[model samples]
Structure formats: structure tokens, C-alpha cells
Target: MGEPVNREKPLRVGIIGCGKIVAQYLESFRRLQDVQLTAVADIDMERANAVAAEWNDGGAGEGGVRAVGVEELLAAPDVDLVLNLTIPAAHAEVALAAIAAGKAVYGEKPLAATTAEARRVLDAAREAGVVVGCAPDTVLGTGIQTARKAIDDGLIGAPVAATATMVTPGHERWHPNPDFYYLPGGGPLLDMGPYYVTALVTLLGPVVSVIGAASHTRAERVIGSGPREGERIPVEIDTHVTGVLVHESGVLSTLVMSFDAVATHSSNIEVHGPQGTLAVPDPNHFDGETRLFRLGGSEWETLPVSAGYVGSGRGYGIADLASTPEGQEPRAGGLLAFHALDVMESLLDSAHSGKSVAVTSRAERPSAVPLTSQEG
Candidate 1:
């Protein structure tokens, strides 16, 4: 266990990386009393300044969020936790820096570039006695949590298999900085697979082994919408990846992730069983309708909102972490992120080796979220 959280005070937060995703977290921080956004930083100082200048707390408290250099944010006495939103490749580096500075950390997913690097980050946090939380906290919201409750209630009756599918043309179309998406740690599987994989583990259990294959569809892609529109960028990682995961619970999950497809009609995730099939919502979003089709039923039915943060978003995981007891893992914790990373990396390894790979790492299925309201 790490040092105990002081229940009377809010966890002061400093955010690193002012990319597109920072906007979402900013909105959530406005709602969470468990956390206070104290500072914003980025390699691009202008971007950091803009974020600090734009955020408003509606006169709640804390004076205001200020812009700071990366080094300055890490050194700030007010920041009790560092929110690392850097690119996948920089995840471990930033987390280690924050841990070195004696701050808790919560980052956007895939944990790190690889399981080995993620292991280093977690080891350092362990040695430093700081808590580490990672995202795709979307699973902590109603969609997946309701689905989880359904299965736990035996609505699916011993899940036999599941299919998770996510396909996108690419992030270059919308993101101003899209260069990192094609890098080693930023491929389709590594970039987007965390949501599906983490959700699968949340609803099912940890994976023990996996078989996989992958493809690279193009040499380069043109920026579709951004300051650099029409500029072509080289693709370094496989754009499409498919894999089958063998779960420790005897459940199997088949995953399909691709940046090559224009679109797809498949449900984000579907679980099958002797009793029924569940159409889980897109794991990327916080809330959506979860539908169910029973063995003898002719029509699909939508499940009621039975679990999760009713209207939560990106950084609720940090609030969850702040509220977690001393010895418990946050719903979106590092162990799960590391296990998900190992699964994806192993899938790619299996893709290259043409053989099944054993996933040596495993994480407990994170605790399910009860129905919650963060409206305070």
C-alpha cells in the first residue's frame, strides 16, 4: 500500500501535454471536487498558455490554473498528482519524472510504448510509494458497467466468447498533431485497442494467451484536416491488426482493430453465451444504450442504466483514484493498463512469429463501478 490519501482535501493536479484530449479532461475537472486542476504544461509553451488562459472554474476556488513549464509543473509544491497526457512513447518518461518528484500519476492509456517500459514505470512508482492510474476510464461509465452487471447477474450465462471491433480511417484527419499515431507505440492496436481490451477484461477476466496477425495498408497518409492539411506523413507501424485472446476464465475474445477501413457496421463489442448475446456500447464513449438479445427473444432490448457514472468523461478515473482507499486499486489502474499493453504487444509478436504467444502478465478484473452521479 502507498501513503494514505487525506480524505479532507482535494487532490491537486498538474496536467502535462496540451493536445486535443486535454480539452475533455478540463471539462471533467470542472465537475470533480476530488481534484483541482492546478497547472497545465506542454512542450509547446504557447499551447500550455492558451489552455491555462482559457479554463474557467466558475469562481469555485484555487485562484486559477496557471501555465508552467514541464519541469516547473513537476516541481510545483501544490500539485499532488501529475496527469500525463503525452504521446504513447513519452508515457513512461513523464510518469517516472512525476514519481521521482513524489507525485501520484494518472495517464491516458496503453500505459507505455511496451510492456517492458510500462513495467519500469510501475516499478518506479512502487519504489517511490506513489499511486499510478491509467485511463480508458470510459469502462467505468454506464455502458460497460451496466454490461458488467448484466453478466454478473447471469444475463449472459457464462460468457463463451466476445468480439470487439474498432476501425478508423485515421486520426490524421482531425488531430493537428497526427505524426505519433503511426509510430511504434501508436498503431491501431496500440492506440485504440486499450478501450476494447480493458473493457473485455473488466467484463470477463484477464487474458492468458493470444494468437494474432496484422497488416500495413499504405506507405503514407495525407493529413485530411489540420494546419498541415494535404501534407503526407510516413506510416511506420501496421495499420490493421486482428487477434484472439484466451482469457483465464475460459472466455475467448476476438479483436479486430484497423486504421485501413473507411467504416464498419459491427457493434463495438458483443458477448455470446448459452442464454443470450449482449451488444455493448462503444467503449470509447462514457454512456450509450446497451442492448440485449435473449435465446428465445426475437427482438433486441435495451438495458436500463443500472451502473457507472451517469454522465462521466475522460478524467473521472483520477477522481476515482483520489477516492480509492489506501490498499485498493482504482477502477482504471496501472496493473490493468500494463496487462492490456502486454496483450497488444504479444498479439503483434504473434503476428510476426506466426505462433501463439503466452501473456506472462495478468491483472485482476478491476472492481465494477456502482451507479454513480458526479453532479456535485
Candidate 2:
């Protein structure tokens, strides 16, 4: 890959989605000196205009950021990269367009709705010589990273196995537009599995094969918020998914992702070896308590933070990508995202076939993050 030109300047970014999630990125951009938000776009012009108007006035300078059509934003000279926060189905389409325009791209999780689409995105970026980064960068933050440090330090000797569990009644109980959560591209596994799978990859290694089983709990769900309240949406995907991932390192990770359960008291994830077990915090958050219990210890002890971006949040991955050397993949790059997607998709496939599916994709464990603040 050719080195990106002008590495010293802050990356100029154009955003292509203005949904609820964009607000988190806007907040992060306000503090990250390595990225400059130059424009905003969305299929909903009103939403795009509102975000542009709200964020452009402050430190953006001069005429400020433009609220343009998606195509206009893609072609804008000021945009060095595209931050794609579009819905899952549109991820590959928008990313391919940005790559075609000769811009690096960072996107929200799953990379694309399917591994096939994700592969195309990665292939296109490789041919274009631009970088591709994906989310669930939450793995790069203190919560999961701290847990990773303990495991690497052998607090849990020769890691043997793990369990990751996430359960909730349903997003329809609160999400205004909960329909997408039930769509093919959405589901407990696809919607929430990225965070857990990415964290597992970060803490263990890449998954090689999976055995899975899944179930659908309901055909329709009622909206619980916004103007759509009381309305029902069809559920087209399995609501509860269970799987076992065989990591390349031979660690087995049992996974349970569900929208059918009311709650779960289990740790979001737990890694076990002969000597100890790690109680990892939620992969969805940037910071939380990580506890460890040795075999002979009286109780679990909270470990002090030892690694990763301190006080970081949603868009840290973009900033990390901006700081990465031109030809190198960012720590939260597409390869890892693709592998995580493959693992999830493979699990779903196994669920249908009642057989183990060998994952065709693998990612190098992303380099570890040393303890550091975002501005450090």
C-alpha cells in the first residue's frame, strides 16, 4: 500500500449518517484534535442540516461544515475520509462509494451486513490503497483492554475457556425504531454480538470454527417509544442465539446473545484458566470495573486500570486510525471486523445446519494498547 500523503495534518472527515448515533461521534470530534469534521450528509436532509447547524458553528471555522447531499459529500475536496454511520444494509454501499472517491473510510459495526459484503469493502479498499476501520472500538478502551492485560500477564494461567452472555427482553421495549433489530441484518447476535466478539478476539485470539443453535421467540414486536409507540413490527431473524467459538489459540468461548430473556446476572464475559478467572466488564461501555479471582483467593478483586485509551468513547477508533502510520492497518481495522462478522455469520449458519462451521476468515490479534489518555 502507498503511504497516505500529508500525515501531519488532522484528518478531514465527512459523515454520511445523521441518526441517533451520530451525536456520539459529534461529541468525540469536538474533543479529538486529530480529526476535523468537514461535512455531514444523510438521506434525510433535515437531519443532516440539523447536525451541520448544531456542530458547525463552534470551532469548525470560516464558512464551517457543509450540509450536503451524500454524493456531494463524497466528492468534497475537504473530506480526507468518510465516517460511515449508515444503517447496516447501506454500510458496504457507502463505504465502496467513499473508496471509489479515493477516501479512507471508518464505519459503524459489523463492517457490512454480511461477510460477503464486508469482503467486497475490504477488497475494494485494498485495491484503492485506502484504509478501512470499523467500530466496537469499545474493545480498545479501558474496560476490555484492562481485562486483556490481566490475561496476557497470566493472572489467568494458560487461558483455557470463556463465556460471553448478553440478554435483554427486547429493544422494542425502548427503541423508537426497533424494527431494524428484527430484520435479517439485525438480531441479538448481529446487533450486539460485535461488541462481545470483538472483545473476545481482543482478549483471546481469532475464532476458527463455531457450533451454534438459535430460536425465534416472537413474530411481531410492539414499539415502546417515539411516534411509533403501540405499532408492531415483524421479526424476521432469530431472537436468541447460542454458540461456541473455537479460537485459533484453542480457547473455547461459549456465547449467548438474546432478546428473548428479561435479564442476565452473569458477567458480560469471563475468561478461565487453571489459576484464575477474569470478570470482564461490558464491552459496550468504555470504562468499568474488571475483577479477577484466583483459584485460592477468598474473593474477586478489582484490578487497577493497566491499558488502553483513558476516558475514550465511540469515535476513538477514527482518531486511532488517523494516528496510525499510513500503510498500516489501524488497531480496530477492517480485518478484525470482518473476522468477527464471519464468526457471527458462521454461528448463524451452524444454527441452521446443525453442524459446526469452520470460519474461513482469520485476523491477527490487534496490537495491544498501552495505558494512555486520548491526548497523550
lDDT of each model, Cα atoms only?
0.91, 0.92
Per-candidate TM-score against the hidden true structure: 0.97, 0.97
Which portions of model 2 miss their true places by more than 4 Å? 1-6, 57-63
- Candidate 2 is scored at a TM of 0.97
RMSD of candidates 1 onward, in order: 1.4, 1.5
- Candidate 1 lDDT, tens digit per residue, 1-376? 3343454689899999998899899889888888888999999999999888888435534699889999999999888999999998999999999988988899988799988899999999888888899998999999999999999999979999999999988999887779999988998998899999999999999999999999998999888886899999999999999989999999999999999988988999999999999999999999999999999999999999999998999999998998898778788999999999999999999999999999999799988889998756
lDDT, candidate 2, at 307: 94
Clashes of each: 0, 0
RMSD of 1: 1.4
